[model samples]
Target: MKRLLCLAVAAASIPVSAEDRTLEHVLVSVPIHRQESNSVLPVTVITSEELQRSVATTIGETLENRAGLANSSFGPGVGRPVIRGQQGPRAITLQNNTSSADVSSFSPDHAVTVEPLLAKSIEVLRGPSTLLYGGGAIGGIVNVIDNRIPRERIEGIEGAAEYRYDYAPDLNSGVGVLEAGFGNLAFHLSGTSRSTSDLRIPGRAIDEAALAEQEEMMGHDEEHEGEDHEGEEHGEEEINNSKGKIANTDTDTDVITAGFSFHFDEKGSYAGFAVNNLNNKYGIPPGAHEHGHEEEHGEHEGEEHEGEDHEEEEHEGEEHEGEDHEGEEEEEEIVRIDMDQTRYDAMVHLYEPMDSIEVVRGFLTYTDYEHKELEGSEVGTRFKRDTWETRLEVVHNALLGTEGVVGLQAKSDTFEAVGEEGFIPKTDSTELGLFLIEDFHRNEWTYEAGLRGEYVERDPSTNAASNEDFTNWSASLSALWQFDDNWQTGVSLARSARAPSTEELFSNVDAMDPEELVTHAATGIIEVGDPDLDNETSLNADLALQWHSANSWAELSVFYNQFNDYIFLRNSGEEVDETAVYDYLQEDAKFYGVEFESSFHLTDLGPGALALDLRGDAIRGDFKDNGDVPRLPPVRVGARLSWTGDAFGTWVSVLNAGDQDRPGDFETDTDGYTRLDLGADYRFSFAQERELLVFIKWKNITDEEIRLSTSFLRNYAPEAGQSVAAGIRFSF
Candidate 1:
């Protein structure tokens, strides 16, 4: 690694073209097809080149380093993006302008199905996009766009292939894309394969101090250690304490997609369809589900000791009878998940479908998804969801000096979960929404406004709880002013409402006996949902200022939100079967934050050009009566410096996260960390505009023991240690 780094730096003398770091003039599809800089909303777009430089197994991990974002990772297999201080249902994830229709929002351990490596670009829209996507996006929206169903004609055949390997996780990944066009017909194909071994860490997997404190609170001591010894003597297997690496953290995934498009007229009218299939299998960390078992064993320790000798004799007599059975059981005991999904999407676009209508668009999609959690060889739980969604939009001609689009969306879902840990009952849900947005330009100021209304209904399989219905409304307005050539300012305000999700309303535990109450193994807690929950509403405001030049630009934004009837799972300060009890509850809350980003490019720096980028963000959340919110990300600041020549470029970055001290009710404080990384890339241009790019990256160069405050498994699993990753991409 050292030699490679030296060679990359020493190659600066080679004559090459200076790399152009200018922002592309691409339109962000998620926000009404407007350029990010000109829109009233705060948007961040990651182009294809930037995505290739840094892509990970999960979308959250891939975008975690971006300003105002964090990864709520579950071991090395699962990661979901947490925006500002909100996650789950509040922050929506979309693929090509529609919901991915995955169960990631149901639990932190579930993975989002959208693959970042296969995307053409990614758009992150901050603040309320509720008026367009849904009320669920009261926090933000992340849309991954791909050209699987191309709307434009391609000249001929073109493709790209890449292979990457990482040291810490022993990961191997390969991706390929191929596209062809003939006349007015176009076709696309893409696939990716990835696999990994257990993750390497800086030290022990378990935080001994935190574990000891937890055990003490559970009234446990060394006296309970004999329980595990007895189990081992009786031929039962035990999970050993992991050192230097996190056990059961391996993963394997595969994805394939095929699409076709046909253009009907010369005026840019087209129809397209695409199909995608994905399969993944991954393991959960060892300590995630062991806490409840330890607490239960501690509670029974005294009783077991009284009959220790009698039990020993009984066990000795039956040892031979159960040995074979125990061995068979041992083969299947590691906790893992196997999931698959198949999705079909179709869209239609028409130019001048009617008078005063510039365009008419329609989109439809259906998804079939299922997953099973396995304990050893036995299925512990199974989750399945079938979703159908459709949307229609009309882009009308300017009316009264204003341009706008009106849209209608409808969706239906059938979801089921069965097994030991199926806390929420099966349910059917439906939603219908109508929305309209318009923009007006006048002199140096541009103003935009939108409004949306939705109706939602839910029906469960059980009669213990009746069906529920809700009606919600959302609206937003913003103004942008370009008072000078190099300066701009924007202000936005929004009021959004979201109906409660199925899991929040239908997680049933009242029917089960106290001793047999169902528990969510991933979280190791007993959760009870409220059937009478009301819609959550939010009032938000934002202010931003930006300055730009030919090679330099800077932007700063501040935002505040006040929520009514904010929904959260709260610790009830109670226990059942030695497990803590948590209830879905509502409270008024407030969140405020600031984010800033700046980049400067310079010339005449030792045979090459240099660029500097700086970023920082901070947020605070509190309840009107309670203390702080739980699992909020810490304040972070980072900087990167890069040197670019005609053919070779290298960069170095340093990021520091402040300690998280206000870990709301029943949570633990987390220490801060500083991480350093280095990377380099060299391009080789060939004939026919074809090119090959080789890149190398060194992550966590210092091997810091970093624990993310946004993760529930932080105390049991640390992030990966020092590692090197290298890859080569061939584009034609």
Candidate 2:
């Protein structure tokens, strides 16, 4: 590792292109066909070139500690992105501009379904994007774009494959993506498989919060220790907590997809369809999720030899367990997540400029998704969602003296969850929305405006107040001024509203059920819902300033959001099912934050140019009467010293997060920590215009014990310890 570090920083004379560090990357997720550096809203585009070098098993881990992003992680297996301090129903996750339709938004323990290995790029839109997407994007949207539908025809055959291995978790992953075309027909295929063993941690995962809850779990440990005399208490044994490792956090993931498209070849008219499926099985953090028989499973390793003698009989018994009421009672059920999704999408595009319309597009998608919480062979809970969505948009060259697009969208989703531990009630949801957007440039001023009206209805099988209907309107207005030759400024104002989710309205039934059953897996507290919760309304104002050039760019944004009826889940200082009770409540709330991104190129170095990239964000969340809102991300700052070389490139960064002392009611304070991360990649041309890329990334190099203020399971499972990941990719 040390020698590799030397090779990374040591300058080798390889001419590097300065344009590689420019901000001219075209962003496909931009509402308007504008470059990222000129977009009105804050958009961060992680290009395929960038993502390939920093890909991870989970999105949260992949983006953790970024400017305004954090991972609400439940061990290594489960991590959901928390954007600008908002998660769950507030942030909308998307794939190719459509909802991911996964359970990750339903619970913090759930994992995001999309695979990064197949993505061409990942776009993150900051702040409210309700007019373009929907009310669900009040927080923001993350769109993962891939060639699932073969938007463009390939000349012949082109593909990419990658193999990766990580040291910390003993992980191995293989990925392959192929694109081929014959005449006007194009086909795309991609697949990835990944598996990992238990993750090693810096310590026993014993933080202050864990220490407080350890008393209740002492008995389980004692019982297992009594089963055998391993001399763990011997004089030669190490006593430091670092000797212990995080348990039950292993994961295995697989994804496969196929797509085909037929194009006009002459005109820009094309139609395509794609099918994709994902299967993932991963363990929950040890203490956070447990099956009653902790001692039995804990000592299984010691008893494995004895169990092998009876393995044949045990296998036979499992087959006939239906006949025996209490079959194989000794088999310990491991708490894990088993999920799969099969999705189909079809899209049509016509670019033959009509008299008034410049382009016309239609999109339709159907998804069948299901996930389960498994305890041994029995499923503790099962969740199923079936959705059909359709959208049509018309882009006109000139409309009302401005260039703009009008769109109509409709969707129907049926969600059902059943099992002993299903917390939220089943519901059927439908939505209809009509939106219009216009943007025009006049002299030194650029103006944009949008309006959207949506109708939403939620019906629950149970007659609970969770049933609801609403017709809401959202609008946004923004204006940008060319302050100078290379400087621009803009301001935007919006009125947005969001209806309650089934979980927020009907979850009154669940107390984080498993959190109570498994003391360690607790999601901080038990949460109940108020069916009478009203829609949340927010008025937002944002100001942005930017300076852009060929080799440098910088942007700073400040925003303030005021809410009349802010719905939230708050700890009520009570107990339900042996866990602290949290109830869905509403009150006046306010949020203010600042986000900044900038990159500057210095003088040319040996064979490359040196650049300093910097970013940071801070926010404060509060209620009118209540002291503070819960689970807000910490104030953070980070910087990267980058060197762009022709064949060899590297960047080293240090990220610092301030301590979170102003926790919400019933919340605990978290200590702050600093982390160092390093990345190095070398590209070699094996053939003309074709390259093989080899990269190495080292994360948490100092092996800091990080407890997230935004995650409920932080105390139980800190982030992964020091890890070294290396991978090679072949691309044409």
Q: Which segments of candidate 2 are over 4 A away from where they belong?
A: 1-18, 21-23, 209-244, 265-267, 290-333, 508-526
Native-referenced Cα lDDT, model 2: 0.70
lDDT of 2 by residue, 510-606 (tens): 3334343222122323447677777888898988898877788777787888977777655453433434445677788888877776777876899
* TM-score of structure candidate 1: 0.89
Off by over 4 Å in 1: 1-25, 214-239, 292-333, 352-355, 509-513
TM-score of each: 0.89, 0.86
Best by lDDT: 1
